[model samples]
Every structure is written in C-alpha cells, then in structure tokens.
Target: MNGRLRELSREESLRRLASVGVGRIVFTHQALPAIRPVHHLVEDDGEVVIRSHDRTALLSALDTVVAYEADSVSGDDRIGWSVIVTGVARRADGADRYRHLADPWADGEPGYVIRIRPELVAGFGLPEDNGHAP
Candidate 1:
C-alpha cells in the first residue's frame, strides 16, 4: 500500500502498447460514451490500427476523436501499467502501407482499416517497490 505510482514516457508507453494485442476503443455513440473491445496492432510510428466489419459502429467513426487504451497487470501482486491514447480516428485506404498490419481476432474478410494517430499519449504504473525502481 506504500508503493508510488510513476508516469511513463511517451516512448515507454508506446512500447508497452505495442506489446499488447487487445485493447478498448472509446468513442461517442448516441451522445454517450461507448467502449468496444478490439484486437489492435501498434505500428512503430505510434499509430494504432484495427480492422472492423463494415457493419460495425466503429467503422463509422472515421475522422472523429476517440480514445484507445491498453494495459498489462499481474494478478497475484496487483501491479500493472496502463496506457491511454487520445487521437483522431481515420479510415486508412486499402493502399495505405499500414492497412495490412491490422490483425483481426475474428475469422472473416476485414472491412475497414482504422488508424488512430495519437495526439496525447499517457501511461502510468504501480511498480513493485523493493526500495528501488521496478
């Protein structure tokens, strides 16, 4: 209970984000906040990519502001790090180089490739304290 929380640098945040494959996308739907679980890929340039079906609401979120989040946690010790990204969501044309980087968890033809170019990237963690940085 005495552990301190530290902020993660943008580089570290993106690195952690890239290491995870599943995250949540938050956007406004019907004037309320909506969250959807999605499988995503983080490009080296810090772009988050995901593929969605044509009928999915997220596909309609192109050119809008959205938030994406990913995290990792330890079950036994309750230590974890979480990264949140806020950015504009846009649909990437099929010819976009990173379009093929989207890896969907489902087994169907991919629909739209959406890329979130982060404007704000923030992360924090409760590192296990053993009288030193974890």
Candidate 2:
C-alpha cells in the first residue's frame, strides 16, 4: 500500500515480459475491442511469440498492428507490474519447432506461431517504496 507507481524502461519492460508466460492479445474481432487470453514466450532475439490453433480467430490479426500484454501481481500486497507490447503480428517460421514453449488450455493443436516485433514497449510497476533505487 505504500509503494509508488513507476515507469519501466524498454529493456526492463522486455525483461519483465519475458518473466511471465501468459497474456492477452488485443485485436479487432468484429470492429470492437477484441481480446484473447494466450500463452506466450519471448524469443532469443526479443520477438514475442504466441501459439494458436490453425482455426483461431487470431488469424484476423495477422499483418495488422496489435497489442499484447502480460502482468504479474500480488493479491495481498497489491503490488505488481504490467507490460504492453505493440507491434505487427505475423506468421512465424518453423512453427513446429516452437511447439514446446506453450502449454495451451484449449483442446486443439496449435499449428501457427505468431511473432510480434516489439516496436513500442511500455511498462509500469507498483513496487514497495523501498529506500534504495529500483
């Protein structure tokens, strides 16, 4: 409760993003704000990768600008961090090779790997106001 909200740098934001496994991909489904919860991973080159079924509605997002977000929070202390990545979504190469990175909650098999190049990365954190600089 005593923590302060602070902005996270791009490198720190990407690091925080790589720490989490789940997030939401925001795109247009029917012209309104459409979002889908997804499992994601940060690649060695810093691209954000996400898996989806071949029939997924997320295909509508391909070649378009989209937003992906992930966050971690503590319920009791109300301290947490969130990262949002904005970039163009595109079909990735070697989809079969990255299959093991995600643990999907749905029943269908994932046939696509979507990669988002982090064009604009932004994040914020609510950390306990410790005396030392974060």
lDDT of each: 0.76, 0.79
lDDT tens string, model 2, 27-70?
88667888888888997777999987734578889999999998
Clashing pairs in 2: none
Model 2 segments beyond 4 Å from truth? 1-3, 54-56, 77-79, 129-134
Runs in model 1 lying further than 4 Å from the true structure: 1-3, 76-79, 95-105, 129-134
Best by TM-score: 2
Give the alpha carbon lDDT tens digit for every residue of 84-128 in model 1: 999999988662454454445545555667889989999887765
